[model samples]
Target: MSDDLTTLHDDGVLEIPISLESAGNSLDGDSIRNGTDALHEVMRGHRKARAVLLVGKGKNFCAGGNVAHFGGADDRRQFLRGLAHDLNTFTDALYATQLPTAAAVSGWAAGAGMSLALHADFAVGEPGTRLRPAYPGIGLSPDGGMSWLLPRIVGLGRARTILMRDEVLNAQTALDLALLSELVDADQVYTRAREIAADLANGPTGAYAAIRRLLMTTYSNTLSEHVIAEADAIADLSITGEGVEGVNAFLAKRAPDFPSARN
Candidate 1:
C-alpha cells in the first residue's frame, strides 16, 4: 500500500488509515487502488485479520474525490471513468471480504467518502460528523454505490430528498435515519469502533462471514431460494471448528474460544 494508506494488523483487527494531508484524507486514484490491494492481501490470508477498521488520520474522515483533478485532467471523461473503476474495485473487495468491517468518522464524509462509510457493515461516528451526497452539488451523478446503498439505508423517499436537495446531514440526523450504526464522542470514535470490531473478532468468524453473505444475497433471492441458501450455509458452518466450539461452550456454560484466534 502507498504511504497515503496505511494498514496495521493487531489482535485480529486490520486497521486501515485513509490519510491524505493535502485533501484531508479525500479519496483519490492512488489511495483507492492501494487500499484495495491491501484488502486483497488480507483476504488472501497473508494476515489473520478477523475484523477490519477504517479510520481517518487527519481532521475529516474523507472529503471525497479531489475535484481539482477533474478540471486539470486533459481528458476529463477518461480520468473520471478510471477513478470510478478503481473506487468500485475497492468497494467490491470490501463487500466481499470475510472479515467484518467498520468505519470511524469524526468529521465530514462527503460524496464518495459517505459511500465508503456506508459500505462498512458498522459505521461509528461522532456528533460533529457530517454526511452529504455532494454529487448534485457538483453537477455530477452518484458513484461508489451511493445510489444503491443510500436508499437501502435511509429508505427511498429520504434518500431521494437527501441526494436531490444536496442535503448535509448532522450526526444525530444521520443516526435517526439509520445511516450511522453508533454515535460516540469525537475522541472516542475510533476506540469505540475498535471495541466493536474486537468483540466481533473474538466471536465465530465463519458464522460472521456467512451472515454477511446471506444478508447481501437476501434482497435478490426468492423466498424459497433464500431459505435453501440459509439451510446450506448453516449446514456447512456446523462442521467448522468455531461452530463446534460454540455449541460445546453453550452446553458447558462458558465462553467459546474460537480456533480462528490462533490463525
Candidate 2:
C-alpha cells in the first residue's frame, strides 16, 4: 500500500517522500506507516540501504496535518488524536534508526514538516525555504517531536520564541539558528541531499550508528556516565572490522573501504 512512498536506491540511499497525493503534502496514516515500515526494513537488514533521505514530492515539503480533513471529521477528537499518535510513532521510528539520515527541505517545512527535518542528521534547504509552527496557527500544541527537537537544535530561548510567537523563519534565519545544515540551489536540493546520503552510506556504518546513539542521549547522562558511554562505544567499535580498516587506511594513507572490510 505504501511501497510508492519509499524508494531504496542502488547506492543505498532510502528516499522517503513526505507525502503522496495528500494535499499540501501533509502526512497521513498510510504515508506514515509506509515510511516507518521502510525504515524498519533498512534497519533490520531486510533492505540493503544504509542511509535515509527525506524529500518532498510537491510545492511544499509539508504543510502539517490535513486541516480540511480535521475540520470535516465526524468525530474530530478521535480522528485528530489517532492522527497524532500515528505521526508520533512514525517520528519515533525515524529517530530511533541508527543509519545516517538527511532531509531535502526544498520548500516550506511548516509544523510537522519542520519537526521531520529536525529529526534528520542533516537538513539541506534552498534559499527560499521557510518554516513555521503551523500547529499553533490551528489552535493545537506541537506534535511530530517538534516540542522536543526544537529546543535542542535552536537554543531553548530561540525555540520558545519561535513556538510561542509562531514565527515563520526564512532560510537565512533557519540556517543561522542551525536548523539547516546548508543551503543549495532550489533545483539542487534533493540532488545535493542524495549525494550526501550516498557519501555517508559508503563510510563506516557502525561508527555512524554509535555516534548517532551517543549524541542523542548525551543530554540525559551525567558527566561520568556519558564518559563511560563514550568509552564503551570506542572500545566496541575498535574491535569491529570498520575500525580496523579505518586505522589501517589512515596509516597507509589511503581511503577506508568499509564495505569490503570483514565483519
Worst 10 residues of 2 by lDDT: 20-29
Per-residue alpha-carbon lDDT of candidate 1 for residues 1-263, written as tens digits (9 for 90 to 100): 22446555566777776546566677756667777887788788776668888877687888888888898999999999988998899888877677888888879999988988888888999999999999998899999999998888778998999999999999999889878898998999988998988887777888889998898787899999999999999998887888888888889999889954233
Q: Rate the local accuracy (lDDT) of all candidates.
A: 0.83, 0.85
Quote the positional error of residue 77 for candidate 2 in Å: 2.1
TM-score winner: 2
Pairs of residues clashing in candidate 2: none
Candidate 2 lDDT tens digits, 72-152: 999999998898888887777776677899999977898888889888888999998999988888889898888988998
RMSD of each: 1.9, 1.7
- lDDT value, residue 100 of candidate 1: 88
Candidate 1, residue 16: lDDT: 73
Using lDDT, give the best candidate's number. 2
